[model samples]
Target: MLQIESTFDVQGDFGDSGLGKLLDMFRDMSDHDEDPGRFVVEKVIEKIPAPLRWAAEPFEAVLGAEVNDQLDALVPGAGDEIQAIAGALSDRARKFAIRSVLDVGLDAKGRKTGTHRIETIIQVFKEARLELPATELGDKLAPATRIPITLGAGEFEISEHRLKFPAGTMLSRALPRLVIPGVLGKVIESAALIARWFACADTAAKVAEKLDDPRAGAIAMTACASASKSISDQIEERLAKIDEEGRLRLEGSADEEGEGTYPAGGWRGAFRIDKEVEASIDPQRNTFSTQEQMATQ
Candidate 1:
C-alpha cells in the first residue's frame, strides 16, 4: 500500500515507441480522410499509460496476437516500428509495463476498468519500492499532453505459470460418445464423408486446437478417423435416414407385384438394424453354477 505522485514524461521516451507510432499514425490518417473514431481514441487513452517510462530488463515479446489486432486497428502500419521500439525498451521499462498491465485499479481518469486497463509500468514500479530515475532530461523537452498516470499491482511473477490441458482429456471422453452416431453414420452412408471429417481436423485446428506439426497433425487426425472407425462402425449397422420432415420410415422395400412391393417411384435403403430392445440385468447376467456357489459357501 504505497502511492507516489510525479509528472509522467510521455513524448521523450515513447517518441520512438508505439506511443510515437500511434501519434504518427493519427497524423497520417489525418493527412488522409480517415477519422478513426473518438471512441477508439478514448479507449487507447484510457488503457495505455501515455508517454510513461517503463523498462523491461531484457527484451521479450509478451503481448499476444490479440494485441496485434488491436494495435493494427488503432495504428496501422506500425507493427515493425512497435516491435523495434519494444525491443529497444529497457528491461526495467518492460517490467514496468507488464506490472501495470497486471494490476487491478481504475484509470487515473476512471474511464477504463480492469487490471492493466490503465497506468504505465514505471508508475507501477515506484509502488513496488523501485527507485525511479529523475525526469530532469524530459523536463527540458516540450511536454506532450499530460494523461494522469496511476500504477497497479506492485509486484507479480508469471514465469512459472502453467496451462493445464483439461480440454483434451474432456473432449476425448465426451466426443467419442457425443459424435459417434452422426459421424459414423455419415461416413458409412457416404464414404466420401470420411474425407470431410479428416478435413474437419484442419477446421478444428483453425478454430479449436493449435497444431504445431503438420505431419504429426496428419498422423493424429488419421488416428482419430481410425479410432472412430474401430469403436463405432465395426459394431454398428445401417439405420434408416430421417426424412426431411423429421420422420423415421422403414428402410427396406416390399415387392411391387406382391403385397410387400413398394411403389415404383418410392426410394428406400437396403439395410436397417432391428431396434427392438429387451434389456434387463437379470436377463442378460450370467447365472452361477450350483457347484461354484457351493464352493464359495
Candidate 2:
C-alpha cells in the first residue's frame, strides 16, 4: 500500500495592518484637535489612494454628518476645534469599527496555545511537502487492488485485479447511533424545557434519544412554556438553597472565632457574591438554566 501522510498547519499568521491604520487615524485626530486645519487631516485624506477615493467619498460625507450630529449633542459649542477633533476621530473610529468587524483575533492575546502552534506547524509542513515531485513508486503500487486505482497527476485507468483484497478481511464500518452519557442525558432533558418556550419540535424526542429513555418522544411532545417555567423555578430554588447553606457555614465559622473576629472576605464573600450578581443579570445564564431544565426533564 502506498501511504501519503500529510499535515496541515493551522496557527495562521501575525500582523494587524487594519488595526494599525485605525491607530494611525486616532493619532492623527488627536494631533489635529488643537488646530482643525492641521497637516494631519490633509495627510489622512491624501492617504486614501485614488482607486478607493470615489468609494470612500460617500462614507466621508456620512461620517462628517454623524460627527457633526454627535459633536452638537456632546459638546456645548460646535466650534472649529470641536469639528476638527470630531471629524478626525469619527473617521478613524468608523474605519476601526469596520476593521474590527472583519478582523478575527483582533483582540486576542499574544499567548499561542499548544493546539494552535501545533496546527500551524502541521500546515507549514504540508505546504512544504506538496512542493515535492511525485515518485514512480506510487505509480508501480497502483495496479494490485480490486478497486480501480488512479495514480500520478494524469488520470489513468486500472483493472479490478489491481485493487484485489483477500477474502474474509474485516471491513470496518462506523455505527451511526446516539451515545449519550448519564450526565449529558440529564442536560438534554433540561434543555428540552427551555426549547419548549421557543416552540421547538422534537426537543423531548431528541432528549429521549440522547438519554436512551423510553418516554423521550412523549416527554418531548409535552414540553411547553409551563415546563420551562417549572425548570427555572427549580434552578432558582436550588441556587437559593446552596446560597443559604454557604451563608450558614460562614456564620458558623464567624461564631467560632468569637465577637469582632469574623473573616472579612474569603472565596464566598468575594468571588461567589460577584458571580451570583453577574449570573442574576446575565441572559446567557438564563439560557443555560433553560437548557439544563430541558436536558433533565
Candidate lDDT scores, in order, read: 0.24, 0.24
User: In terms of TM-score, how similar is model 2 to the real structure?
Assistant: 0.17
| Model 1 C-alpha lDDT per residue in residues 1-297, reported as the tens digit of each score | 111121111112223332233224324322311122222222222232322102210111221233334445544543333333223222212222101112222445553222211122132211233322323212321122222222223321111111111111211122122122333434324422223222325322321223233443444444435543543332222111111111111111112222221122111211111222111111111111111110110
How do the residues 1-297 of candidate 2 rate in per-residue lDDT, one tens digit apiece?
111111211111112222223224334434544322232113222344454333333343333344334334443344243333334332322210000000001113422111100001100111121121112113311222122222223221222221111100100000001112332233223532122112223333333444465554454444333445554454344333323321100000011122212221111111012123210111111110000110110
**What are the per-model numbers of colliding residue pairs?**
22, 33
